[model samples]
Target: MTLTALRRDAPSGKADWLVIFLHGYGSNGADLMTFADYWQGSMPNVAFVAPDGLHEAKDGGFRWIGKRPAGDPKLYDDAVEAAPDLHAFIDGELSRVGLDASRLALVGFSQGTVMALHLGLRREVAPAALLGYSGGLVGADRLSAEVTSKPPVMLVHGEQDQLAPLYGMMMSVKAMSEAGIVCQGVPLAGLGHAVNAEALIYGARFLLSAFAFREKHGV
Candidate 1:
């Protein structure tokens, strides 16, 4: 299935890096595409794409898979079942742009975060980085066996998040770290299950560092 996306080309009219935004469940691509506008000033060489989820949520927007609550044991199975389609989408986009994994970064929010961590970790070639907000990892028990890459990761969660609490993020980070993944976790005090200005700043910085442009003549 072809996933429709909103794209923003590099400000310089040429591109070197790609940042794919995956919105939370019940949210659409248009919702997160706004970040492109906010970030283009700092990442003029990076292209941004935000795609609608693979399936429509029963209540409203979209989903990467069947709708399920956070921390559900079945989420691992669901993510596994749903991964191929997302993988295809990412791979297809990368191939279309003539870019390789080194130039790619996946930024995910909520359920999108699950997809980013899962697929990013298993890529045959590691993405430049993975950034997740308000989301936790799934399939932790199987990560050791399934993981193929150890790309650096930055995860931010609201300390007071009720839906997917800070504990979940901590656990996820712990597991990834145990597996030798370089991971950073930011727990925003009193923040909820939503992104805040601070998180956005951190995310932007993470992307900049992850996708920094290195001129051929200089270090």
Candidate 2:
């Protein structure tokens, strides 16, 4: 299925880099476009895109997995099921933007974070960075065997997030390290299941640093 998206061209009229925002469960691409609005000034040459998930959520909006929550035990299976459609979307979007996977940063929120972690490492060419918010890695158990590339990752999570807490983020950090992926975990104090302005700043810096590193190394 072809995923629909909201896009923003670089202010400088040069798409030197790409930033794709993957919104949370029950959220649409338009919701995450705010990031583009806030980031456009600082990243004048970076184009942005936010894609809607293929599956529609029951309450409203869209989701990467099935409409309902499928507990932790099957979370991996759920992500696996959602993979191909998202992969196709990412691949198609990159091609359309005249960029490769390495020139992109996958910025995910909640369930979108799960997709970023799952697909970033598995892609044929690694993304410049994976910046995830309020969502930890899914399919962690299968990562060691399935991981194909190592990319820098920044996981921003609420310290008190009941849905996907800081502990889960720590676990994800461990999983990334075990798979040879470089991951940085940022735990926001007193926040819960959401992204705030500070977290957005960190995400922006992470993307800038990751892309700079990739270019410095000539990757």
Candidate 3:
């Protein structure tokens, strides 16, 4: 599966780190790329890439996999089938940009968060960090049996999120912790089903700490 990506190259002309942003359902790469501006100064040597999901939705949005609120087995199977393609796309992006997997991080929102957690856990070479907002672990029951990587994860969700409830976030943290993967979760009070300024700041700090980039560069 060939995925479309929007890239923000490092201003320093050398990227020591790479961040791949995955947007929420019904959104595209352009939506998440906007955050790059805020992160650029703090991570001048890091490149950002946001990729559009594979399937187009009726509301002019995209999805990595079809939704099935009824807990349909087929939909879950489709998501599993789609995972390899998404993983391949990541590999292709890394090769194209001349960056290895070690310097990379995965960030996602909502449905994209599902993809990030699912794929990032199974990757042969784990990413430096995984940051997810308004999302939970899909196929959580099978995570222990399937997980290959144990990278640190930071989960952020709004306490008032009706779309993907706060409980999901709590459950995800618990499951990941039991799986022996380092995990942190923050629930922003009175917030809704979207990323907030606080989430971004926390996410940035998590990424910086995971990669040790701030300390290395004296930032």
Candidate 4:
């Protein structure tokens, strides 16, 4: 559970909010931490950290599900299997930074998104928000039975993404909504299997609003 990570401290040197970025397969934490740069000016009070996946990928970077062929069902099963380690890192980092679950935001892409949903929903103290990009829900049928909290969620996907298509994102939305979680789905008109400027902006504003809502409602 002790994974290496990349961090960007808040400009104030004291963070009121924390954003944890989870990168896709074969990608490192540093790859997703670039989001911090785009939103730093807007959210001066926020700290960002991206943790490398549990295992290294064959090509380079890291992976959450271990080595599995492209269409393997075991990939999904093991993503759930990988939750405890990621959860450990999350809990440990939140304590190390002096923030509790209410101030934590999870931002995930591709395989990482699947873990975010699985772990966030099962946490005893719900995260402030869960934002997933380019990935669908894993073990959705089990969610109703296992979910302990229903944090606000945002799912963003590219219309032309063949890897993890838009329909998959919508299906995640449907699953979360049916479970009584507030969920939003955004589709980028022509984006491929990648995050763009628009996604960053949307994510930044969404994080800000999530924290604001938590403060206002005190939930």
Write candidate 3's Cα lDDT for 27-122 as tens digits: 999988887877788888888999999989768878887775523456457669879888888888788778888777899998888889988999
Of the two candidates 1 and 2, the one with more favorable lDDT, higher being better, is 1
lDDT of 2 by residue, 81-100 (tens): 88888888888877887987
Error of 3 at 182 (Å): 0.3
Runs in model 3 lying further than 4 Å from the true structure? 70-75, 213-219
Q: How accurate is candidate 4 locally (lDDT)?
A: 0.87
Off by over 4 Å in 2: 67-71
Clashes of each: 0, 0, 0, 0
Name the regions of candidate 1 deviating beyond 4 angstroms: 213-219
After superposition, candidate 4 runs with Cα above 4 Å error: 66-73
What does the lDDT read for residue 34 in candidate 1? 82
Q: Which lDDT tens digits does candidate 4 get at residues 1-219?
A: 689999888898998888999999999999998888889999888889999999989998898876544335676689778988988899988998899888888999998888888888988888899998888687677778888988999988999998887888888899899999999999999998999999988888888899999978865
Q: Alpha-carbon error at 45 in model 2, in Å? A: 1.2
Assess candidate 2 and give its lDDT: 0.85
